[model samples]
Target: MALRFQNIKKKFGDLTVIRDISLDVGDDDFLVLLGPSGCGKSTLLRMIAGLEEVTSGEIHLNGRQVEHLPPSDRNMAFVFQSYALYPHMTVRRNITFPLIMREHKWWFHIPLVGYLAKRRIETKPDIRELVSITAETLGLTQVLDKHPRTLSGGQRQRVALGRAMVRQPAAFLMDEPLSNLDAKLRTAMRAEITRLHHRLGGTFVYVTHDQVEAMTMGTKIALLRGGDIQQFGTPREIYERPANTYVARFIGTPPMNLIEAQFQGDSLRIGDRLLPLPETAPRGDDRKVWLGIRPDAISLTTADAADALPVRVTLVEHAGAESLLAFDPGSLRVARDEDGQSDIMATQSGYSGIVAGDRVGLTLDIAQASYFDIDSGLRID
Candidate 1:
């Protein structure tokens, strides 16, 4: 199912949850709304599901506007962070509740009487068969007769998913559905959900604050913050070519290092020294700029390299196969070398972000590193 969120806005009294948000999920696309807590990801998902009303704008599903449609009529299913299973109902009953509702319009899907109507109509067997198949696929077959209370967290989760799948809706909306699981189970569930997405071949709009989930599972990622989208792109595009400083910092581990500098004709000045920037970046004098470098893009050593700046070592953190070294390049300046230049030399206030006591060489990968206009937060590519 294709889904479009067109200028969707949501607010509660004075608080805006989503503002002028627009996004599209092609049929069968797996889209992740990735962000930190209180970023309005859940709010967006709810608006799509009709669990929450949009303060403004509209939502479309499969070319049809569904902003006013109740969740039931939207041809979608929502799996919540809470397993949301009925404790008194057995797995079979829970999974078939929707089917039973369809059969008995007046019964409201009473676990006991809904099946009675299904039996009278001879559709009970068919419902059982379908539910059983879904349960088996989700690894909930063995717990078919157990109450949700008796199942483990993972088992209960599968049951919740089973309930959603049995409806076979055109799309699935999940809001951090795996957040309650432990680390190991969460990793395993991430793989399982990724596979399920392929198996169903249906639009899946997932919301999560977990970057690990976003990076490993999303085919398309919409990174959001403070009720607005920071960037929306494929995982590779987001990680390699972030649209701005916020997206760059949010998408990476340990985050990108932000070194302040200025543009001095033909050289990039950090604090006091002049160095070269990639010919690709803008050039000017005393232009407020920031040097952005991913941790992996940086390396340290005692050997001499053309652009390597030597500095005092601060701390070394070794994580299994790789190690990280902290260094400060010393002083700062935004001046072009005596040689006529087009860009400002980079200044290295040094990486002593906090305790500045020693001078260490800081090497900038002008190639991999990005320059941003500090005042505007726009990339200087």
Candidate 2:
């Protein structure tokens, strides 16, 4: 199902948590609401599920307004950060809980009668078949008879997913479902969820602060900050051409390097070095701009190479398959925090023999660089 949010706003007393947010999610699209904590990503998801009331505006599910509906009335499944499985129940019982709730009547609340009715319902061929299919699909058939306490973290998470899957809801709303797992398990589960999304072909609205998850799993990403969207686009579009400096700093590992420069005539002046502006960069005369260069785009060059900028290596980290080198751009002005000391990072494949304190010549790939307005922090196209 497709989702549309029109002028949505959420406020708590006097503080507005969500601004006038407006965006559309395509059907069967994996749209990830990515941002830091307290950015209203979870609040937005809850509003869609009807768990939180919208202060104003409308939410549409497949063209039907649903902002006024209750949680039970909305046909969407929510998978939370906590697995939220019933510890007392077996895996089969947990996965079958949604179906049981759907068919439950008033008499199902009576202790003795409820027990017999539930057993009978479980014995039904259709219910049994459905449970069996879901368990097998999630590789939980082997543990169907086990309780939650006996299962591994990943298995328990899968059970939670199976519970939601049994409902066959229009969309899957996940609020950092993999955050509880270890780094290794989170990676594994990320792949599993991506595969599940492909197989189910259901609309998924996921909320996460981790950029890795947003980049790898989402077909479309809405990057939010201060209750407003910084950029909304595919991963490549946001990574390659960020809407502003905020996004440029938030999306990458070491993040993009922002250097202070002067855009004059046909060249950019960074400190004492004058380099040709990127072909795609906006033209301006004596304008202050921020030049953004990705870590991998800067390469180690020979001292005699043309246009080579001299830098002093400050740190060298040997990560598997790549080396991250931090260098001090001697005369070039770089963006820094209150500490006033931030080195520019460059990535080199495999081991780079370069060490800290070593002076090296580096060449910036101007063709791959990005320029932004210094005052506004917005990209200069």
Candidate 3:
């Protein structure tokens, strides 16, 4: 089902948390709401689930207005960060609870009368079959009788997911569902969730503060900051061509380096060095500009070559298959280090022989660089 948010706004009296946010999530799209803390991504998700009220605007589910409907009436399953499973109930009971509530009348919920409810439920073959299939799909069949506390973190999360899956809702809303897992488990769950999305073919609206989760799992990402969306696009589009300096700084591991420079004719003046701009590079009348270069795009070498800018290596970070070299370019204010010194980064494959205090030459790929307006901080190219 297609999910649409039209000019959605949320306010907490004097504070406007979500400001005119609008997005269209296509059917079966894994739309990720990514942002830092206090960015209103969770609040937006809650509003869609009817857990939080929308101050203004509309929410449409499959072309039907649902902003005014209760969460139960919306036919959407919510998977929470806390899992929110019932500790007293077994995994089977927890997974089938939603189904029972929906199918059985209120009188069946009474303590003594619930015995008849159990018999009625066992008589219905579909509910039992669904619970068994969901348990097997989530690898929780062995733990179907186990309490949540007895299961591992990953197993508990699976039970939580199983609960949502049995509901067979039109869409799934997840709020940092894997935040409790360790790094390795998080990686495993990421793949599992992606596979589940494919198998179910259900629309998933996920919220997370982790860029790795957003980049790897999302078909489209809505990058939010201070309750406003900085940019909304595919992972590659936003990473390669960021809408503004904020996005350029936020999306990557080492982040893109932003060098303050002056545009002079066909060249950019960074201190005393003149870096020539490619013919295809964006041009603006403004003399001042922000030049963005990803770490992987800059090549560092010991030998000096034409068009190479000499730099003093400040630090070399070794991370498994890649190494990040932080350097001080002649006079360009690219990024700041702990010592308040300006630094730029170049990434190399595998381990590096380069060390701190080593002098190296950096060759920038002008064609791969991005230009932004200094004043507005908006991308120029």
Q: Quick one: best lDDT, which candidate?
A: 2
lDDT of each: 0.77, 0.89, 0.87
Decide which is better by TM-score, 1 or 2: 2
Candidate 1: deviation at residue 347, Å?
Answer: 22
lDDT of 3 at 299: 92
Q: What does the lDDT read for residue 322 in candidate 3?
A: 94
Question: Global CA lDDT of candidate 2, please?
Answer: 0.89
The sequence of per-residue lDDT tens digits that candidate 3 reaches over residues 34-56 is 99899999999999999999999
Ranking by TM-score: 2, 3, 1
Q: Which lDDT tens digits does candidate 2 get at residues 1-381?
A: 389999999999999999999999998899999999999999999999999999999999988899999887788999999999878778988888777777763445535444643585567888888888988888999999899999999999999999999899988999999999999999999998899999998799999999999999999999999899999999999999999998998899878999898887889887777888756778889999998999999999765666887888999999979999999978878887435666888999998898899888878898998888999999988
Judging by TM-score, tell me the better candidate of 2 and 3.
2
Model 3: lDDT of residue 170: 83
The TM-score, computed over Cα atoms with residue i paired to residue i, of candidate 2 is: 0.95
For candidate 1, the lDDT comes to 0.77
Q: What are the root-mean-square deviations of the candidates from the true structure over C-alphas?
A: 6.7, 1.9, 2.2
| Local accuracy of candidate 1 as per-residue lDDT tens digits, 1-381 | 399988999999999889899888888789999998899999899998999998999898999999998887898899999999878778887888777666565766455564563363355567778987998889888888888889988888888888899888988999999999999999988998999998988899999998879999999999999999999888988888778778877787656666777788878776555777667777877887877777667654342445565555555545545555554334432222224221212222234232234344456666787777787777776
Q: Give candidate 3's root-mean-square deviation (CA, Å).
A: 2.2
**Cα lDDT, model 1, residue 311:** 57
For this target, which candidate reaches the highest TM-score against the unseen true structure?
2
